[model samples]
Target: MSYKLIPPGKRRNRHYWLRGTIAGERVEVSTGCETRQAAQAWAADYVARLEGQRVPGIGEVVAFERAAELYKAAHPHLSKSDIRLVGAVAKYFRNKGKACHEVVHADLVAAADELKPGRAASTKNRKVIGPAAAVLHYAANNQWCTYQRIEKFWVSRKSNREPARDEDLAVLIANVEAPPRRKKFGRKADYNVAFKRLLLLMLYELGLRIGHLLTVRWDDVDLRAARLKVRIPKSDEIASLELSPVIVSELANLTSATGVNRPALGRGVDRRGRLFPWTTNRGVHAWLKPLTDRLGIKYTPHMSRHKLATDAQVLPDKKAAELGVWKDPRSLHRYQHVRPEAIPGRSAATLLALPAPDKRKAS
Candidate 1:
């Protein structure tokens, strides 16, 4: 086992960073000491423990909080939301600072239970158990503790959002209030209402997550090419989607009316600005809720996504998955919701009611 002292960069902290390696597994930690000798001593002890060397009371054990930091450092490619969720789980155990070996199956179960109230099972699992399992798995891999307990936690649920029906969508569109367009001497007014309508239309037409949609910039749209550059927030990947004629037309009008020239709309589009600047995701939802409620439609931005996914069932599974940016085709199953009104009232038993002619056929 050996240790290396790494100098800090970007972060203007005075303390030196220490990296320890043992049996091909390396862990980098902050020594919290300025002197090289003290840092080296700390790394030596950490390496020895990770190597399964017992020193009296201190054995192969890492605090959950520290382990979380280590895990985060190890996975730099995790998305912003993913990092936040992991941090939330880590912060939950900050006060306790429980050691890896000290964590029991019941503790995880209790955590899951705590998250279960008022939250969807899927949400609870994804936010709580998932991160907890990851932390525990990291601990197990480092020989800090065994991971047999992770198997005990299992959380899943049917998807909450359902596809919006065509009729319902029509109602929503009809209910959408158009923004007041005041063209005084060819000057444009605030396009907030028009933008909201177009945003809803795009969300329905193209199955995009609201988070991804809201971050779209002018640079991301290609009007002449009829393509849109979409950034997937979960995977941090850029995907291209072909624009429909209606969408293309609307976008062209929007750009012309509000493009970087008008005083009202040109406030922020200096270099690279958002197409619809709402500031927060909550603001997007707040703008949407009134129209949906007025229409009496059980709808959300995600429901619009489901609507598009359901409509894309005619496409091949792979094609559908690709369009929806789903990593696995099975993930598409959750979005395959048929409108309740579309279901035929006649059951198979009723539809295939044949006469009892078979009884006389033998004769």
Candidate 2:
């Protein structure tokens, strides 16, 4: 078929585009580049993938909704926050009342264009940028419309910052460590000690999202394997995680006191299976803000993720993917809170190192 020139590379002069199959069919295809040789090579390989029914060179055409459904399937192991982000995208787009079948790249771009620079820029980051890009990227992969890049028009450049130093984070952790505030007669002391301890262990050591951590049930943990299964809510994927021995011991200690540390002045009733049963999302922020205030740690729940993704992610294309932060670094501004301390590398780790991701038997 014919090819259209499109802006290439995410950031700068990476102006390149590919020619893929016609809309709607699954047959793999690819074409177009500065050099005819490169185009021919990609085209040849794309046809091979199509013929074998392998992962085809995809197009960039599906609307936001269609693409998101595919993204959910692709990332069966996303974290809870990621699920929230996907949900946000779906809600925002659907709320517009535009038909999913009729939406196009122009509609998405027009939507992105409507975002104001000085706006609160809070929810827009995760809602508009991260998941929104995922919807587009998936389509681009399928040859939707040579996706140029995802822009962060929501976040003003004023608030962005480099990764928060771990040393700084440690300082913040210490401030909030006064043996859990408790009530003696009628005062409201530290709300929940065991849960707070668990939260810190997760943020500092386990690198878990507060949302997912709150959803964690005792059953998901494999003590023998020393791993936790972080199920990505949006994509419905399950990612295996490694726990440092220190956190494991801390969790073990807390489990021992589950009933002893129960609320209600005497003994807190331990729920049967759920590892944590938070009454609301307020507790997380309530403790974190006060803790950070006392410790002088200037960060939020997601800041830990950003810190972890930046520090831990060591692989290309993996830093964002594994951390479930953003589809690409450009959208980083909107979801800076999700920035991870580490970018996992391909050759180094095996947490999500599964073979034949697309071909694996349904679980």
Candidate 3:
């Protein structure tokens, strides 16, 4: 065996350390065993596992920490939030001295309870359960553990956020288009106003998420054809949408105005640069809040998207899903908030028209 098993000492800490090369891959990790005999056995098993010589049912023990490391190595493109979640799960399991194969449903539930405590079920599912399941599943795929399904906590279906009303949106658009009182900033203020107005229009018309809208460049737009090419961030797919005439007109007006006649100094529609001046959603929301507050309407940037989804309920499921860039047509159900009057065959007039019977007999 080319693998070297070093005994516990000043350098090796309490656990036995395995360091050497196997199959041209450098191996350096703790065996998580105290006795020299156990360490030697672990080192041989690990080398055999690495070389694909060992069967799945063999006495091959893999620590949760090691399994997590392997999972991370396999998937290098995980998002920052996903990385944090995986790290948190690995840390908890490492502290517990848990093996990847030994983890059960109870262990996962306990981990969630201990790690997230009083957090919501959805939060725990995202932060703990989901990440831990991913690591364990990856380990199972590699024969380091048996596959175990981890179920997520059931979350409520009720949503607190109401979709923006047509009247409210109209009021917002009118207010943004009206002249800015602050003449000191002059063109800068006008530019900001114009940008907000256009942003609202696109959010309502295109049914795009706020993140997708912020990243759209001028090259993605075709005002002449009244078309827009939006990059869906989640799926990493480009979706082409037919632009509304209102949006095309606004974009044309902004692009045509230049020099002293322009709203701002910089190019209105740079082919390379993003369409909106703001890089982050926080900046857009901060600018929008005061306007919403002044208008006496409770609104958010995402509310525009909800409004689009609600309005699209009249269309077929497939058509509605396409409008929202949803991968599943069923997802439209979650977003659509049908008004009382809009519910098919359930209008107040229809109920009123029904004959009221048996009232005299009861009296």
In candidate 1, what are the lDDT values of residues 1-363, reduced to their tens digit?
Answer: 566888655672777797667645676778787777887787777776675432213245577877787788888888788789888877777766778778777776667676556776667678887888898888787787786656543444256577765555555554465334467677455446457657777876676888888888888888778788988856667999877767776666664234443222234334357777675789887757766665556778888667666665356666677777766666766543632111112111211133322211111
Per-candidate TM-scores read 0.65, 0.48, 0.72
Q: Give all candidates' CA lDDT scores.
A: 0.66, 0.54, 0.72
Candidate 3 at 284: error in angstroms?
Answer: 0.7
Runs off by more than 4 Å, candidate 3: 1-60, 177-188, 255-269, 335-363
The TM-score leader among the candidates is 3
Q: What digit string (tens of lDDT, one per residue) describes model 3 on residues 106-220?
A: 9999999999999999999988999999998888887887787788889865556688765666667666643355556554335466677788878866657898999888788
Candidate scoring better on TM-score of 1 and 3: 3
* Candidate 3 Cα deviation (angstroms), residue 130: 1.5
